[model samples]
Target: MKLLPMFALLIAGFIPLTSAYVDELSNERVFFNKMLEVLPGNWQGKYADGTYENPTSDWQPIEVNYQITSGDTAIIENYVDGNESAIMTTVYHLDNNDIRATHFCGAQNHPRMAGRVFDRSSNTLSLNFVDVSNLQTPADYHSRGIDLKIIDHDNVHVTFSGLENGEDSTRVFALTRSQK
Candidate 1:
């Protein structure tokens, strides 16, 4: 009879700890969940001035698409160029309670980044390069990082930063949801 009462007390002692752990995990994933909520669609926009590959003063058209994949374990983003060809693909997933992205670049290398900073008030997430694969050289062109800003469900702003020949390159996009 005494053992029954002791076991009940022991079980009750662990309830709060388990609940707190679950709550902590949920809080840690809020930003990732928000991204999954608003980014699964087609977006059309233009490259910001002075960033076009051809060095045009005019804004060049760009398209991006996002879809949930791997049984909702990942989000895949595809970048479409003016020629309507896929230029790059990025896969975003959560690992070790952090948001991580693997960018498959047209430059023929893969750069992995992690989103360690998230601003809830601004709805912004910044991911910086951690490691890479297939990089032939240290100076090879590859994506350096990405900054994602969610303006709303229908609009977003993204800045893709890269390194080319060991020089910094950046492109900014202001995208609106495409009805088509």
Candidate 2:
């Protein structure tokens, strides 16, 4: 009888971790998947702070390519900046209506963030930090959030927010879909 109570307590402790995404809803997944229809193509874009990323104008060239594989669940985004000088990838999947992504950073840690439509009537997707596995609290640098605004069938705006040099900052990108 004494052992039974301890066993129940241990099980309860593991529940939250195992069910962290319990709030993910099927209706939300349906909408998120619907929105993904616009993603699987190449895009030409420019960063918001193009002058800083490139010595040129504020519209420095960047390339974005989206590839979908493994059925409807997995989506991959590839970013190439300034004639392939910098490259990074983000992998996403749907959990109900909530979308989760693991950003493959060039630095030390791979930060994972979660996203959902800002509002049921809005097309903006806002992703915020949930938890990171390899990051050591305030010691390691990582991205804090991202906002994706779908302007139209061919235009999108992406914003990435990060903790850089112990301060918060953001970078924006304006992307246009490629015909090919």
Candidate 3:
């Protein structure tokens, strides 16, 4: 009779711990899956700013198509200035509890860009990248940075900031989701 009571108490204590362990595992899977969903697709928008020499006249639309190859890999193809195209590849992974993306552009010439993801939600996602190395122009020593925020499944807001002549300037980009 005494053993029965002790066994009951032990089982009661073990139940809560097991439940918590299962819950933690489930949460991790949910977060990982959500991260994958917001990362792949096509995004389009326009860039605007008054800092350029021909700001008003140079207002141009931009479109980006992204394909997430895996949990840690993606490719982005961008179109700007009506007909100019640029291709960039990014490899993303979790580091120090934060998601980081290493981007490469001009695959043969100006490749090697690095960035991190700071925020993500159900309907919104944001990415920030700062140029670390530029093989395109060594004398220029310029860095390009971008912040992209998704407002919905089809609309996004982007901010482009970069160093020019050792000074920083910013431009805003508004985009809509294009049909795949």
Candidate 4:
């Protein structure tokens, strides 16, 4: 029948679109799995503002513990700030074929970010601000971005960017995976 051919054509046209979507999902799964492989551990480092090239005396101790929980569906990062005795947390998980994160900051706001760029060859994942929750004011401080790089199995460099006091601020931490 004529309708049979028409329906076949319609289905055929949608096949490519579905395949492309599936390919994207597969890539995201691969990226997230790679992240799980490299990110679960206790990391110790020093933190500094802007550039971490300041004198050792000026740098503060930074300790981070990453755990895979919720049936391995989420990665949680507990960030300890030695200078302020503050502990912040961020949770990373996949949301419908996209990697997303929610950072709980000391500013009393949570900023949600999504993975904007993933360079598999370099082992880098960059997340940019999407929105914020519990923001009392438009100018209230909240995290803006995150840049995470795995230098090696035991070394990592992370930078967090935000707006504070109406100025762009950054915290850089150079971390080494703790052996003990």
Number of clashes recorded per candidate = 0, 3, 1, 0
Candidate 2 segments whose C-alpha is farther than 4 A from its true place? 1-27, 50-57, 82-86, 120-122, 133-140
Cα lDDT tens digits for candidate 4, 1-180: 999999999999999999977766676667778768988988898888885564333678788889999877799988876563438898989886788899998888999998777666767778899999998887888899988777788888877889866878888888999886
- Comparing 3 and 4 by TM-score, which wins? 4
Give the per-residue lDDT of model 2 (tens digit) for 73-163: 8888889775754387878888646788888765557788887546444566778887665666675567877777777789877777788
For candidate 1, lDDT tens digit of each residue in 1-180? 999999999999999999876655554478778778989989998777333334335666789999998777799998997786889899999886777899998899999998856666777788999999999999898888888888899988777788878678787777889999
lDDT for model 4, please.
0.82
lDDT of 1 at 77: 90
TM-score of 3: 0.53
**Deviation (Å) of 144 in candidate 4:** 0.9
Q: Regarding lDDT, does 2 or 3 come out ahead?
A: 2
Residue pairs clashing, model 2: 28-97, 29-96, 29-97
Question: How close is every model to the real structure, measured as TM-score?
Answer: 0.76, 0.71, 0.53, 0.77
lDDT of model 1 at position 104: 93
